[model samples]
Structure formats: C-alpha cells, structure tokens
Target: MNTPKENTYTCLIVEDEPISQEILEVYIQDCPQLLLKGVCNDAIEANTILLNQKIDLLFLDINMPKLNGIEWLKSLDEVPEVIFTTAYPEYAVEGFDLNALDYLLKPFSFNRFLKAVNKFTGLQKNLAISDLSSDLTITVKSNKKTYLMKTSELNFIESDGDYLKLYRDEDCIVIHETLKAFQSKLPQNNFLRVHRSFIINLKKIDYLEGNQVCIANQMIPVAVSYREGLKELL
Candidate 1:
C-alpha cells in the first residue's frame, strides 16, 4: 500500500494494442505519484481528451493507425511531457529529439516502467521548485532607490565587500546586500553560487573557458569546491 503524493501527475495513455494498453494501465495504477486520466487507442481520440483536459504526462505509442505518434506529436502546438512506448528501437532517437522524458521499449519490466515514471516525478519536482521561485520577487535598495526585481530577469550577482552587484544584461546595480542574502532569494535551479564572491545565472552562461564561465562576455571564476556541482549542471 502506497500513500498518495501531495503533487500527483495526471497521465494519459495513447496506445493502439490491447495488450500494451493493459500493461500500461496496470503499471499506472501501481504508481502512487501518477493519476490515470484516460486511455485512448489512437492519436485522434487522444487529441480529443488532450483538448478537453490538462494532462501532465503522456504515454504515447509510436506505431499507431492514422497520424502515428510522431506525426501527432509534431502536429500539436503544445504538448505534455511524453514517454514513447514501442517495440521498435529505431524511433528512440526521434522520441528524444522531441524532448520525450524517456522511451519505453515494449515488453519492458515494471522496474523499467518505474524508471521512466521516476524521471517524470523528478522533472515535476524541479518544475515545482522553479514555480515557487518564479512567483517570488526580491526587494533591494540601489542608488538610494528601492527596486523590486524579478528573479527570472537577473543575469547574475557578484559580491563586492558589503555590497552586491546585480547584473541584468548591460545594466549593473549595486545593492547594499550580502551575496548570501541575495542568493537566498533567487531560484536555485536558475542561479548558483559558483564562487564565494560571485553567483552566476546558469541559464545566462554563454560558454566555459578553463575553470571560468563567460556570462554576457564577462569571465567569472569557478571555485574548486563548486566545480563538480557546476559541471553536473552544465
């Protein structure tokens, strides 16, 4: 018996074969993190449900009748996170190209199904964290004026003694705030403290050059302790 998770991901299964659909239905029921919304046998039927509801994860089978999985996926203006299920291994590369979370080869074990679901859970967790930070705004006093800054627009923050420099594109503002204090208000997924004196926006990075990261054409040092963690992110 598994307790329900606070954040459950709504899922839809679009597979043509009866045996495959049964296997997926059983697997989804056993996973506490997933909530089965609807099961459809073809892309056309799946499209109807997708338009009427909000699906967080989609278990799509590549080989289907009339507008096959790949064709259907490409047709959509907006698509949910997908996990491609198929007997053919040839479509694996194309599935990943479309940014499917994971590919499930047919006759896959419960363990393998769980692995793909875990990837979905992990992604949802990160998205939840990011959403929290996205809604938050930081208040700082710069140049004798107070400004409320959006966490998403911040390029980076550099520590300068008691003052912290907040960079946004070509503009720089000096706020009388400690680097640690400023970092505490930022999104952990988008911002990371690379050095004690510098915190760079992970998304704003242009390139890496020998222990240094170039953000907006400015080279920032990477500390030894944070190197491994930064490498993992990059």
Candidate 2:
C-alpha cells in the first residue's frame, strides 16, 4: 500500500483552450499530491501569476496568440518544472529545447494523464530521498507486464505513432505510453530532449554530428530547432 506524501506541489496551467484547461483542472483535483495554483490564457497572464505566487510546476501550451510557450520560457531566468501541452507535433522538439519535464498532446486521456502524474510523483520521491547517487529504477508496463528499468540502462527513447519506444544498449521495447509520462520520471541532469520525437540519455551519447546524435550504434536525428540547445547539452 502506498501512502500519499505530505508535500503538496503547486501547479499553474497556461492554456488558451477552455476545454483543455477544464480537463487539466479536473485532473489536478483528482491528485492528492498536486494543488492547482491558477490557470491563465496566455504567457502574459501566466507571467502575472508567476510574479505573485510560488509555483512548483507549470502546465504550458505551446501555441498561443502572443508570446508562445517556448518563447515565454526562454525569457524566464528562473523557471519551475514545465510540462508542455500542444496540438501540433512539430513543436515537440522546440518544447524539449526549453527543458520541459514533459510534452502532452491535446485531447489526451485520463489514463495518459495519470501516467504523467505518476512520473511527477516518482521524481518528488527521488528528490526527497537523501541518497541522490543511488541507482534509480522505474517500471514501465507493456503487454500487461511490468518491466523494471534502470536509469543507466536507457540510451534514448523515440515516439512511434501513439506509442513510445524505449531503447537500451541492445534492446528496444515498445510501450503504449506517451513520451510525456516517461519524461517526468527521468532526472533532468542525465536525460535531455534532443529532438521533437526523441529523448537521449546525455551520458550515453558518444558524439553529435550536424543534426544527428550518436549513442552506441544508433544515430538519432536532432531537429534543427532543437540543435542549438542540444549542442549546449553536449
């Protein structure tokens, strides 16, 4: 049995769509570990909320009328963990460039939302633990079987249609999970989102070419928009 921790994380939602905002709000209400700070329609309004409050997490939408999510995050010198939500798949790489904790597509289901929240919970637990260097493990369920994954074993992850493919040294496992969910479980230090559809383990990267990253024998393409930040990571 798992007991809810006493620490409550405050989250702010910066979404223009009313329906999406409501859905996210409901999910926040269902989670005992999260508290809704506020919801804003655009980056301008979100900046106001940030100025007047203490936020632990930000649920931001990529496209907006003015000061898009990516641009707004880039302007911020001090930012909380960000989870980007968008309808366009192309923005995925740009979202990672901002160092978002996760990227959620619009019209996401409750189960998928739960997975992202679970990742947030796991991260919180790891932060609370005194031992930071301990070998961390997480479980991903595929075909109704739970697979234990060590952080060090992960090389990179790629998006496959609606599913996500997890890559290890020589093994590749496809799971019916979103990249957003797994992103939350990973530590920010070792894992970096180098492309729209890919997240690479920084430690596993051997070298980087013009728009590709070499990890073991795999050469992953790095989106042009994300190349600058990916270069900084390398």
Candidate 3:
C-alpha cells in the first residue's frame, strides 16, 4: 500500500461569496494534507490571517471588494503557493503571471479539484521521498471495500471517467481513481503510462502491432508521442 503523507500544508481561503467560501472549505478539508487555517470574505480579512498564522498555501479568489486577488497577490513580498479559484477565465493569464500553482475556473467538479491537489501533493512527495515513498502494494477501494494488489502482478490499467479498470491475470478490479493519480503511485521503473488514459506493465506485453501492444488477448494503443520513448525503454 502507498504510504500516507504527513507533511500537512496550512491553507487559507480568501473569497467573498459565502457559498464559494463553504465549497472551498469542504474541498480543502477533503485533502488529508490540507488544514484549513481560516476563510476570509475579503482580502482585508485574509491579511489578518496571514499575519497571525503561517500559511503554506492560499486559495485566493479573483473578484472581491476594495482589493482584487491580482492586486493583493502583487502586494505581497513573500507569497505562498497560490491556487486561484475564480469564476472568470480572463484572470487566468494574470494569475499565472504571478506564478500561481493552478487556476481553477468556477463550477469545477470534485474530481477536477482532486486533480489539482494531486499536483500539489506530487510536488511535496518529490521534496520528501523518504517519508512519502510507497510499498509495491497498491490499495484501491470499491463499494466501501479496500483491496491491496502487488504492483508486480500481471496487468494493465485503463481510464474510465472518474475511475480506472485494473486488469490482472484473471480478474479485473474497478476502482474509483483517475488514471493520472493511479499512475503517480506505481513504480516508475516497472509501469509505463503509455497514454493519457492508460498505463501498462512492460513485462506483460506480448508483442507490438503497429502502435498497439498486445497483452493477454488485449490490445492497448500507444500514442505517437509516447512510442519513441517506449521503444527506447524496451
């Protein structure tokens, strides 16, 4: 099973709307590494929280009274990793210009939010590999039951919307996890993410037909961009 991350990031939310603030608060709570410091209705309130607490990350909104997010962000001397959560797409360029970690357009689904947080957590994992490194067993939960499977087992993984289908020798396990998140947990040397939506074990490949890989009567397509790197690995 993958090791749990213990380096929690203290997060502060600066948003004007009550509904948006509540939504962001819940999302932050869902991530085990994120501890919500406080939620502010405006930049003025958030400044107080920043002064009183050491915030590792900030979920700042674009539109607010008196001072906007961009203006407030520009004012800071030393800023934390900021993820802009806003209803406007026009502010995305300005947000990234300030070196924002990510820009989340309003009305984003939970899966979308999870994907963004995954990027943040992935960076943390790289910074502290000794603490975050996993065992070869991958744990997946389906219908409230968790299953642990070894990474070395014969298999390939396919994306299925907000989930993935893990095909082993004789059994296929369906788990509620995106392919991207699942790909990050696997051993990089043993598993290859051949496409955006699929990852396969290199040892299980029977043969390559054109851009497709035949493994245990299954055909997995390899994207043009990944084929050259895959050939080099083989």
Error of 3 at 155 (Å): 51
Candidate 3 residue lDDT tens string, 1-234 = 133346877788899989888888788768888888788888989888787778888889989998998999898877988889999999999899998889999988788888888788777678677334433777888878898888877479999898888999978988888787888888787688888888999878999999999988999999999999889889
lDDT agreement with native, every candidate = 0.90, 0.85, 0.84
In angstroms, the error of model 2 at 230 is: 23
Give per-residue CA lDDT, model 1, range 43-138, as digits (tens).
999999999888899999999998789999999999999999999999999999999999999899999999999998999889888777665687
lDDT of 2 by residue, 140-200 (tens): 8888888998877999999988899999977888898778888888877788887779998
How many angstroms is residue 152 displaced in model 2 relative to the true structure, after the best TM-score fit? 28
Query: lDDT of model 1 at residue 70?
Result: 94
TM-score of each: 0.62, 0.54, 0.52
Q: Which order, best to worst by TM-score? A: 1, 2, 3
List per-candidate RMSD values in Å: 7.7, 15.6, 15.1
lDDT-based ranking, best first? 1, 2, 3
Name the candidate, 2 or 3, with the larger lDDT value.
Answer: 2
What would the TM-score be for candidate 1 when compared with the true structure?
0.62
